[model samples]
Target: MSDAVVGQVAVDQLLEVLDLKELGPFRFRGVSPRVGPQRVFGGQVAGQALVAAGRTVDPARLVHSLHGYFVRPGDPTEPIEYQVESIRDGRSFSVRRSVALQGGRTIFFMSASFHRQEEGLDHHAPVPPGVPAPDDVPTMADRLARYPDRAGIWAAIPRPIDVRYVGEPGWVAPGDRPPDPHQRVWMRIDGQLPDDPLLHACALTYASDLTLLDSVLSVHGEVWGPGGVVGASLDHALWFHRTFRADEWFLYDCWSPSASGARGLATGRMFTEEGRHVATAVQEGLLRRVGE
Candidate 1:
């Protein structure tokens, strides 16, 4: 069989693994309900947690920011319990706090804010110049061909989104020189998502965790290997800029400001092809070298 056919097959399988079901208030049960090798894929928890928060909001409003922490590794085999706290309700904004629990233990906690649309002062940092356009980049599947040895990680990537790095290409083979603290990538879902703005926002939150944290590794001259480093996201925070669709191609520009004492901090912004700032994110993670 051709590599393209094989690649497509792999992506289909990944999407199945990520597709989960709503079981209760702010809670979800995975389609398979089995613990993945990482205890839990942080993205799944983040996305479902957002869904839980979204349920409590007025549909006319949109979520503008969500801050969360991974308190403990989740038990993927059991249904996660999400507890939402209504922090405040105002004319223009509403706040909610959600706690994800399993085995009666706190696994993740998040605070999200919703907003009624209104005009405001508008300005932003311009999208940097000299970066390759999304159209010119190779898809993740194309990059996977370089690492026949770690086929599992390649296959683990979901099919609906195409990810291509515009900077810092490594992990399979470390480059002659490491990437700078900053990196950029282009991505978009391969299929159409529902028009529900909340759903699209939650989906974007899921994908946001993809490579934003990895940019921090560049500062240490490290590359993410399938088995080399012990890594996990500790917390995530995102501030939405305005209405946007994640199903369309957007450029994610990432940079790490600091890393110390086994933790690394990174920040990123998602921009539309025309360079509108859609959202911004910050993530801190445990970045310990494995077998140290």
Candidate 2:
């Protein structure tokens, strides 16, 4: 199949995953992709939880921030039930908490805050200078072609996001990627999306988890899987600063400040191609060498 056709199919599948089924008041259920890892992807859960939270809030209120913790590995074969709590509904702001459960056990929980759009003083950090445009970077397929042995399941899976890495990805061989403190990439949903702002936010939430932790490994020239490091996301947080479409190209500028005791913390900023700083994400994960 052509890349464009594959991208559309992948994106349709992703949308299906994100479109949770409303079971009852403030409760929903979501499913995993038919083909994926044994464990559910963290981004799927986070995005579904956000969707649950967003459903209970006033449409006028837009989600501005979300903080979530991954408590246990999620089974891809089982359905996830998201239970949302209406924490508060103030005059200008609303808060909701969502808990994702499987077999009646909590797998993930999150607190999201929404706000009515209002005028505010605005200033944002500029995009780093000397970074190449999205088109100038190598596509994921191009990079993966160079390391076929390492591609493994990644090559077979459908990718919903078109990612162009500014430098080496985490799957590269040790020492192949020179030690770099930053991991920059340009990405966007592989297909077009509707105009709903909440949908865009939820979409970006799903995309956010894909590469944030790679910054930690990139800083040390470490890779993922056998002969390298393995990790699980412990917690994730995101702050939406402005409006942006998930289907359009955006730069993900990420870096790690510390990694110790088998844990790493990384932060990233998302900016539109026009240099509009739109969002920020922070995550900490448990990282350990294979068989450690």
Candidate 3:
């Protein structure tokens, strides 16, 4: 099959995964795509939990922010049950908390807040300087095709997001110098999505976790691979600042402010190609070098 076809398959499968089965007013069932190694992906859990929260709120409301924790590694072989509880409903604001479970164990938890869209004052930081335009960057697909010998592991795994790095992808080459504290990438869903805003938000939630943690790996000039290093997210938080679409390209600019005591803290901002700051995210993960 063609690259476009290959990309579409992975993302279409994820969209199907997000169409959760409504068990009741406050409960839903979601399944993990049985592909990624070891356990289910963290982004999948966060996106699903946000979808669960959105289901119980009024259609007029939009998610403004969410804070979530990765409680445990999820079982890809089993289904996850999402239990959402209504926290509060105000005139223009609402809150919901959701927990994702697998075989009676809570694997993830999230608290999401929603708002009725209204006109408001707005200001945002411009895209950082010295970053190359997304058009000039080499896409992940291009690099994988360029180096066939080094691309096998990545070729075998087809994820729902298409990512293009502006500079050196930390996972690419282990260099002598510890990288600067930051990294940048362009990203978007691999396939077209419907017009629903909530689905777009949830899709972005999934994409957010794809490479944000790599900011930590960049700090040490380390890569997570066979006998190289190991890490997982401990917590994730996102704030939606303005309207955006997941199917189109967005730039994720990330930096690790600090990393110590086996825990690394990283923050990121998501921007549309037009320079709108759509969302911002922060994550803390356990990072350990276990191999060469």
- After aligning candidate 2 to the native by TM-score, how far in Å is the CA of 137 from where it should be? 0.8
Question: Could you give candidate 3's per-residue lDDT for residues 1-292 as a string of tens digits?
Answer: 1233346788789888898999988999998875655688899999999999999999799999999999999988899999999999999999999999998989999999999999989899997877777678997778777655445345666667888887666556575326767878999897888899999999999989988988888777777664456789999999999989999999999989998998889999998888899999999998877751
Q: What digit string (tens of lDDT, one per residue) describes model 1 on residues 159-230?
A: 456778886553544553365778788977666666878877877887788888768876665766644456
Q: Which is the leading candidate under TM-score?
A: 2
Instruction: Estimate the TM-score of every prediction.
Output: 0.87, 0.97, 0.93
Reference-based lDDT, residue 198, model 1:
82
lDDT of 3 at 170: 55
Residue pairs in candidate 1 whose N, alpha carbon or C atoms collide under 3 angstroms:
160-190
RMSD of each: 3.2, 1.5, 2.2
Residues 160-228, candidate 2, lDDT per residue (tens digit)?
A: 999888998888888687899999999999998888888899999998999999999998999998789
lDDT winner between 1 and 2, please give it. 2
Question: lDDT of each model, Cα atoms only?
Answer: 0.75, 0.93, 0.86
Can you give the lDDT of residue 288 in candidate 1? Answer: 68
User: How good is model 3 by TM-score?
Assistant: 0.93
Residue range with the least summed lDDT across 10 consecutive positions in model 2 = 1-10
Candidate 3, residue 29: how far the Cα is off, in Å: 0.4
| Clashing pairs for predicted structure model 2, backbone only | none
